[model samples]
Target: MSSLWEYANPLKFMRTTDWLLPIVAVAAVVVTTTGLIWGFFFTPDDFRQGSTVKIVFLHVPAALMAINAWLMMLVASLVWLIRRHHVSALAARAAAPVGAVMTVIGLITGAVWGQPMWGTWWAWDPRLTSFLILFLFYLGYIAMWSAIDDPDTGADLTAVLCLVGSVFAVLSRYAANFWNQGLHQGASLSVAPGTRMDWAYKAPLYTCMVGFGLIFLALVLTGTRTEIRARRMKALAARERMA
Candidate 1:
């Protein structure tokens, strides 16, 4: 257990993360492949919406993760800000892009699905507007990271931005609750009298979420490792300059 726990420290983490990369990568591939094949082929069509509704399996989960990922970064950033943990800071940085990608996926998929179901593809409905705000938060967070010259300063700015973003995510999730009406129907799976999803659809939806999550973990680790290496190289070069 002690040996296992040491991996939290940067030095020990360096020794272990590379070994786990292949394992996580393989799991991501297997889950994604199986989930997509089953979801695309075997899942039953929606009674009302028909085939277009299939996009929900992808869109809903990605939207869920996008919001959740920013929350994760908020927590990680808080820890980094308070405790000054390098790994936590790196993790916050790495998670930003993944969350942004997931947000884009959700928005694009939702738009595509809406065209056939709703008369128009776009609407300034509460849910849609709040989600757009959430997407902008992701962009702002990424931009803060890139704008600063000192990486530590960038981390601090982005951490504060992440905290603010978490607040927005909460607002986004609840925006529908506040509104008198919504373009989105209450979730079938998540709400009361939950969706009657067939087993085939349920299985793949969960598998895909798991697959995407693993992919996120793998990418975060890879980015952290690279950040560490880059820092080390910079330090060594500085030492040579001094020598």
Candidate 2:
């Protein structure tokens, strides 16, 4: 934690992350491309859902990240709240757009897939409704960040907002328990041993997921760097004014 805190300064962050971004960027592109090819061509059509099921390659990972990104922000927000770490606040802010993007992807893909299978593009089903609220919450959080003026004020406000948002993530899970009506089936890719593996499908799905994860990392790092620079400019301007 102390080591992380030491790199909170903009200069430190820029210096440390400078060399790594390009490497990650290239890897992300390659992985995503490979995944798409494998998913679209190599993976066999599902026996039950047919070709539309390929959307799972996109939908599942985005949905997983949508929820996990908030959890990441929640942890960063907690760090900021408890220890007053500016980088933690900046990181929480940085994560907002990525999470929002993931949520949007999940919503759109889910709708597209749902229409053909369920005969409706939308549903009041618990899983669908809960995920929708998650999307809305992402919008609201980003809106709040944009609305505020001062960085510290924005960070504090958004930190509180992120904290509030974390509670609702439960909807992602509780949607199943509360309503007992869900459009989504239970997980097909279970981790338990002896779980059936169709190598062709699993190969592409895992590749896409890895690719998406890399892309997400790249986005978060870039966003954090931007926030750090913006803060520095603000500080320098204030110092000039004071001097």
Candidate 3:
């Protein structure tokens, strides 16, 4: 536990990420590119959905990261509130835009995929609606952070907002199950041996998922380091003024 908390220090965090960031970035690029090429070009067209099925390579991973990123922020918010760790708050802030971008990717890909199947570009489906609301929450969280002058105060308020928004995040994932009447389909990836997706699709899909996760990690680490550096510069400027 103590070792884990050591990363909360800005210098230590920066040091650790210095070596880790490039590896994650390179892995993300390689894995995502491979999965996309494999899924799009090499795979057979679905008998029903045809080539449109290839969009799942982008949609599923983006949707998964969209939700998971918020969960990551929620955990960070809790850590900041409990431990007063500035790094945690900065990390949550860093994650918001990444989550928002993932949400947009999910929404756009979903719309593109749905048009051929659902005959419409948009729907008020349970899962889609909740995911949209999650996007709004991400925007709101970012706005709230920027609106305040004091960093700590902003972090506190945003943490509360994160707690409130978590309800929608939960609903976003399970809303289809609870409502039982929605245009959205069930999860594409599953642990069962005989899952809905064939191994051909599942294998590349899994690769994409891992790639997206690493991409998210790399972005957050980069963003958090930027924030830490900015904070340090501000502190130094203040010291210079005092001197």
Best by TM-score: 3
Candidate 3 residues 1-243, lDDT tens each? 368899999989999999999999999999999999989898899999999999999999999999999999999999999999999999999999999999999999999999998999999999999999999999999999889977899999999999999998889888988999889987787676777888889889989999899899999999999989977887798899999
Task: Kindly provide the TM-score of model 1 when superposed on the true structure, using C-alpha atoms.
Answer: 0.90
Per-residue lDDT over 71-152 for candidate 1, one digit per residue giving the tens place of the 0 to 100 score: 8898889988998877788778888888899989988988999998997787998888888888999999889887886778
For every model shown, what is its TM-score relative to the native structure?
0.90, 0.92, 0.96
Tell me the spans in candidate 2 whose CA falls farther than 4 Å from its real position. 177-179, 193-197
lDDT: which candidate is best?
3
The lDDT, on a scale of 0 to 1, for candidate 3 is 0.93
Candidate 2: global Cα-lDDT?
A: 0.83
Worst 10 residues of 2 by lDDT: 179-188
List per-prediction Cα lDDT, in the order shown.
Answer: 0.81, 0.83, 0.93
- Model 2, residue 171: C-alpha shift (Å): 2.4
lDDT of 1 at 232: 74
The CA lDDT at 112 in model 2 is 96
